[model samples]
Target: MHPMLNIAIRAVRRAGNLIVKNYEIVSTVKINQPNIKNITNSVKIELEKLIIDVIRKSYPEHNIITEMHGKIIGSNKDIKWTIDPLDCISNFLKCLPNFSISITLTMKNRTEIAVIYAPILNEIFSAVRGQGAQLNGYRLRCSNAVDLKGTILAIGYLLSLQQDNQKYITKINQIFKHNYIDFRRTGSVGLDMAYVAAGRVDGYFYIGLKPWNFSAGELLVRESGGLITDFNGNHTNSNNIIAANPHVLKSILLKIRNI
Candidate 1:
């Protein structure tokens, strides 16, 4: 195992342990508990701190980017860690068991290692740049889907206050015009892409995902024999991501190109 990958695994597992502990409390507490929102938010902040702590201890010179605190610059500009300590906050607060923790290490503008852990499921998805993706100790391969028909898909969104929700609704309608089997909006882009890499879902697409949101997932999909591209089939800008096996990716691009 790469030394950086080992550190990332340790950081994510530690974060996952924190998530598991707080999850139990949130699950048993009443939904209407006073300041529940504040409690959850505090947990998210602490979780990011824990992850950053682990990374800083190992490599104090490496830069860090996190969801809660944005970016922390270290002496080394070429190497950075991107972290989403808690993905799918809504699901976690709802006790839905669909949230996850994501950590990615990049060097010289390229992803080198990625780790995502779903504490409730006790599943860890990881990948090294040249190595294949893995779930636990086993290797992963994306579904060899050649067409959209009968394939499950995952979609996510990070809508701004002024963004039109109906526009995305129309886009979803356009996608369903094809004969795809089903769709899931898991509220977690990281897990959605990991699922694509794991073949748990055939494909995943999302709009407005920031670097920290999909950095880990992007490498996982690529290392697992999948492709991550924009709506127009370009891999340059990934803010709008579509992930699938090669053939299915092209098919999806065709399906939603005009929408």
Candidate 2:
């Protein structure tokens, strides 16, 4: 493994450990609302701190962008680390065991390393630019499903549904009207992309995601022999994502474009 990727894995593992340790006591802690809880917030904050500390200790010059802390600039402008300390906060609060810790390292605007660790499941998904993706050190490959019929597709709501309600409803209707493909909302976009890389799902798409949410997963999909692009079939970034194998990607893109 590249030295930077090794350090990323270590940081993710540390955060995962902290999350698993506090999982059982989640309910005992106070709840703030339907999706927010004191315990989950505290855990996410602590995990972010832990990950940042680890990165800084090894590469103090690298910049950082995290869900909890927003952005931290560093002297080295060539490198930036994007992190989602807790990818599925609601799942964690509900004790659903579907949450993950995601990290991505980009150099000169190009992703160089990626890691997504699901601690409760002891599954680690990682990738290095120009290299292949992995699951627990084993090579990974995306599904080769060609058609939508009998295939499972994954979709998620935009961050702000109110602002994109008409588009969202139209897209949903178009997808369901086919009645040939099945879909799911996994709550965790990071995990959904990971599943696409691992061939656990045929494809995944979502809109209005931040860099940290899709950074690592995008690299994973690409390195795992999958195709990824924005809604218009352009190069993917943080805005909107559609990832799958070549065949499935084409099929889904055609449907999305017409909608």
Candidate 3:
């Protein structure tokens, strides 16, 4: 592992441990549906404090662009750390292990290293753009399934709208038919992308995501020998990502684009 990635690995692991301790001790959780995002915001802030402190103490002048509390950062230097403290709030509140702590270090918007730790399951997924992706230190390789049949893909949404959302409903219909495989909604976008990187899933697509939502994991999939693009099949931002192994990419794109 690279030196910087080593730091991210340690930090995410420590943060994950802390969150797990709190998760187990909390008897009940407040589930704010309309404000479900705030749950992530709050947890992210708390964890950000710990990470910023560690980073600042170890190496000064490293700016922090946090999703919760905004930025307590200055001009960019050689490094900018992006973080998503908690990836899946709903799952966490429901005592599910899908929630994750995501950390990434980038230089000029290009990811260098990333670490995502899912505490309940004790799974640590990490990736460096050039080095490779890993699960518990074991290397990852993209799935070679050229066809979508039995691919076991994953997809999900942020909030549930009315069934009248014909566009979305139509999408679900098309994706299901095109994928032709069992699918899941784990509620954690980071996990979705990581699964693609680790070949646990053939592909993952989501709309209305933020940079913090998929940037780190985007690098993970790409580094692990996968591809990522917008739903329209353009080389767009990770905000609306469609990632899968190269073998299935063309077919996946054709199937998805039709919807």
Candidate 4:
């Protein structure tokens, strides 16, 4: 195992223990309670601190980027860690068991290692740059669906509605019109992409996501024999992202290209 990957696993597992404890407490409360927001927010902040502490202890010279902390620069500029301490906060607050902790390490602007831990599910999806992705300790592979027929897709929503909402919806509808079995709107990008890597879902796509939303999942998909591209099937643009095995991805791109 890579030393950095080991540290990341340690950090998320420690944070996951805290999250699970709080998850049980939140489960006892009604989602409508005012304090529910406060509790979950507190956990998120605390988890961020805990994860950063663990990383800083191991590599004091590496930079860090996080949703809560923005960016914490260290001596090393080429190596940086991107973290989403708590992904899918809405699901966590609602006790939906779909949230995750996402951590990615990049060197020279290329992802070197990625880890996404779903504490509620006790599953860890991880990948090293050249190595294949793994769920727990087992290898992962994307579904080999040759085309869209009978394939189940995972769709993620943007954090906010974009100006081209109508066009996005039109594309989704047209894609659905193809012979897919059904589509799921999971609202959790980390887990959705992890599912794609593990073949739980055939493919995943979302628009207007930031780097932290897909960095870890991006590495996982690629290591699992999948492809990531924009609506027009260009790898250069990731603002509007699509991920799937080669066959499904090509088919999806064709469906949405002219829309």
Candidate 5:
């Protein structure tokens, strides 16, 4: 493993452990508990701090961008760490085990390493540039399903982008009408992309995802032999993500273009 990736794995493991501990506690507590929000917030803060500390200790010169605290620049301008300490916060708060911690190391604006860890599932998905993706140490390959009919497709709805709801809805309607493909909204873009890399879902599409939300998953899908691009089939840094195997990607891109 690359030295930075090794450090990332260590940070993710530590954060995952903390998340799982809090998850278990929240699971046992009532949903309406007054301290639920506080607990989740506290966990997010602690995990982010822990990860930041770990990364800074090893690579003090690398920049850091986190979901919770925005961006912190380091002495090194070429390397940046994009992190989401807690993805799928709503699901986490609701005791749904679909959340994950996502971290990506980018060099010169390109993702070089990626890790997505789901503590509840004990699954760690990782990838390095030019190397294949992995899930729990096993190599991953994207699905070969060329047709969308009867295949499961994952879509993410960004609640923050309320104005774009109609556009997304129209696209969804167009997809359903054009094919018999099944669709799911898991509320977690990180997991959705990981699932695409693992072949759990044939494809995943989303609009308005932040850097921390899709950076790690982007590398995973690409390294797993899948294509991730914007609606126009161009490389993307934010929002408008479509990930799938080559064949499926082509088909989906056609559908998206028509919308």
Candidate 6:
């Protein structure tokens, strides 16, 4: 493991530990108690605090990008940590145990190191720019499927936002038409992408995701002999992302392009 990636893994594990402790105390409802806002947002804020605390204490010079705080330590076009303190908040609140913490170090706007930790499952996925990906201490590899039908696709919806709900639903309707593979909506992009790297999921496609949500996962996929891009088979951004094994990547891209 690279030194930079090692640091990221440590930080993610630290944050994940905090989340594991609070996970037991979170509300079972989709929305948290005593607050009208969704449970996901509250947990996102809470985990962001923990992540930032660790980063600040160890590497105060590095900036951080967190969902709740927006941008802390630094802004765009700088060397900063892109992070989703709690990926899959709805799943976490529902006790689904699919949520994870994602952290990636961006150097001059390029992702160089990534770490994603699923605490409940004790699965820690890490990847550096050139180094391969790993889950716990074992290396990871993309699956060997060549056809879409032989793959397992992971997807999610953006129903939380009213406008995105329509877009996501429309997209999902089209995705179902593929009929080539099994599908799932685990509600966590971090885990979804990690699964892709670990070969548990063949592909993942979604929109309305923040930068921090997929940054780490993207690196994991790319380093694990998989592919990460947009619906058009272009580079992934915060707006949209499509990831899959090399052979099935084009098939996934075609399905998402029409959406």
Q: Backbone collision count in every prediction?
A: 0, 0, 0, 0, 0, 1
Q: Per-prediction RMSD in angstroms?
A: 1.8, 2.1, 2.8, 1.5, 1.8, 3.2
| Local lDDT at 245 for model 5 | 92
Candidate that would win on lDDT: 4
**lDDT string, candidate 5, 140-178, tens digits:** 999989787878999987677888878888877877885
| True-structure lDDT of candidate 3 | 0.78
The lDDT of model 5 is: 0.88
lDDT tens string, model 1, 30-100? 76767867887798889989989989998999999876788899999999898888888888988988889
* C-alpha lDDT of residue 249 in model 2: 82
Model 4 C-alpha lDDT per residue in residues 1-259, reported as the tens digit of each score: 9999999999999899999998898788676677767766778789988899999999999999877777999999999998888888888888899899999999999999999999989999999999999999999999989999999899876646766666788888988894746898777899999999999999998988876689999999999999999889988646779999999999998889998
Q: Is candidate 3 or candidate 5 better by lDDT?
A: 5
In model 6, where do residues sit more than 4 Å from their true spots?
Answer: 27-46, 74-78, 160-180, 236-238, 255-259
| Residues 1-259, model 3: lDDT tens digits | 6877777877787788778876875437555677656655666678888777766666677877776667767554768888788877767777877888888888887888888888888898898878889999999988889888888878866564444245555765775784568778899988988999888889887767777678888888988999988767788764556789876777767765766
lDDT of 5 at 139: 99
TM-score for candidate 3, residues paired by index = 0.89
For candidate 2, the C-alpha RMSD (Å) to the true structure equals 2.1
Candidate 2's residue-wise lDDT over 41-131, tens digit each?
6787899999999999999999999877888889999999998898878888778888899999999999999999999899999999998
**lDDT accuracy of residue 131 in candidate 2:** 88
Residue 252 displacement in candidate 2 (angstroms): 1.1
> Which lDDT value does model 1 have at 69?
82
Q: Which has the greatest TM-score?
A: 4
User: Can you give the lDDT of residue 68 in candidate 3?
Assistant: 68
Steric clash pairs (candidate 3): none
lDDT of 6 by residue, 1-259 (tens): 6766667777777777777776777644344375735555666777778778877776777787766798776433467887777766667767788888888898888888888888999888888788799998799998878868756889875766778767666766666675656888788888899999988988888877766668788889999999877767877465777788877888666665776
TM per candidate: 0.93, 0.92, 0.89, 0.95, 0.93, 0.85
